[model samples]
Target: MNTWRQTSPTGRALLVTVLLTGLTTFMFLPLLAVHLSSEGVPAGRVGFLVGLLAFCSQGFSLLCGLVVDRFGTRAVLASGFGLRIAGYALLGAGTASATAVAGIAAIGIGGSLLGLAVKTRLVAEDGVPARDMLALRSTFVNIGVIAGPALGALVYPLGFGWILAACILSHLLLAIRLTLRPA
Candidate 1:
């Protein structure tokens, strides 16, 4: 809290965006297996898809660091948010299996990029202690971790498409907020 107060507006915005992204992504996770199973996707395939999603996210984090170095934070963040929006939109539309895989992959990649952008941006800023910034970031992440599954469970009765739509809307709002703010 004190660290956040001492941080710049950019830092604050980045933290908020990270929080929202984490919330949306985690919220979708618990619902994913159930949703896919209900859609008639085999359990083994569902497990594989989930594994693919994690693999892409972890693998792309390293790549996104290079992209951030080359293209700058704004570009990387915009691209990431764009991908997330598109991915969620596809899921919301109930696309075919291949398309669903592509969408999940996109979500994974976008999440990696967004995460890298936030960390890089935070580290680059002057006067903010890296440890404090990271701690604060982790706090926001924990909040999402705690909130998402509970929220998802609470909203489970609403249907899977609604969950996807919520994610899409969250990403869309973040992208718009990023665009309107200075890089």
Candidate 2:
């Protein structure tokens, strides 16, 4: 609390944004297989889809690092938010298997981009203490990891579409907040 108070308002806002983004991503993870299985997807294929998402995220993290260096963090972050919005929209639609796969891939890629951009912006660009900021970030990630699944389990009874809609709203709200922030 004291550390956050000592930090600039912008830093606090950025940290909150990072936390929300992390929450949105992880909230859907545990629900994915169950949701797909409910939709009649087989267990084996659901596992493959989960693995695919992990693979895409890892691959895209490497790619995003290079892209962030070239294009700048703001642009990369905006692109990530855009991809997340699109992905969540597709997921909410629940139209076809292919669409779901593409949505998952987009979410994976966007998450990677966001992870890189947020860290770079805070540590490299804003000159925050890396150790402190990282520690704070880790705390937020852990909170999200715990809270998300519980939130998913609670809301999931309503429907997976509702969960996806909540995620879309989260990303969209973050994007709007980002746009409103001063450069």
The lDDT values for all models are: 0.85, 0.80
Question: In model 1, which regions exceed 4 Å deviation?
Answer: none
Task: Report the lDDT tens digits of candidate 1 across residue range 1-183.
Answer: 788888888888889987888887778998888898889888888898889889989988878878999999889889899888888877777747888898888888988988998898887767879999999999999999989888888777898877788898888888887765676
* Clash tally, candidates in order: 0, 0
- List RMSD in Å for every model shown: 1.2, 1.6
| Model 1, C-alpha of 151: deviation from truth (Å) | 0.6
If scored against the real structure, what TM-score would every candidate get? 0.95, 0.93
Clashing pairs in 2: none
Residue 148 in candidate 1 has what lDDT?
A: 85
Tens digits of lDDT, candidate 2, 17-57: 77887776777899898888888888887888788789888
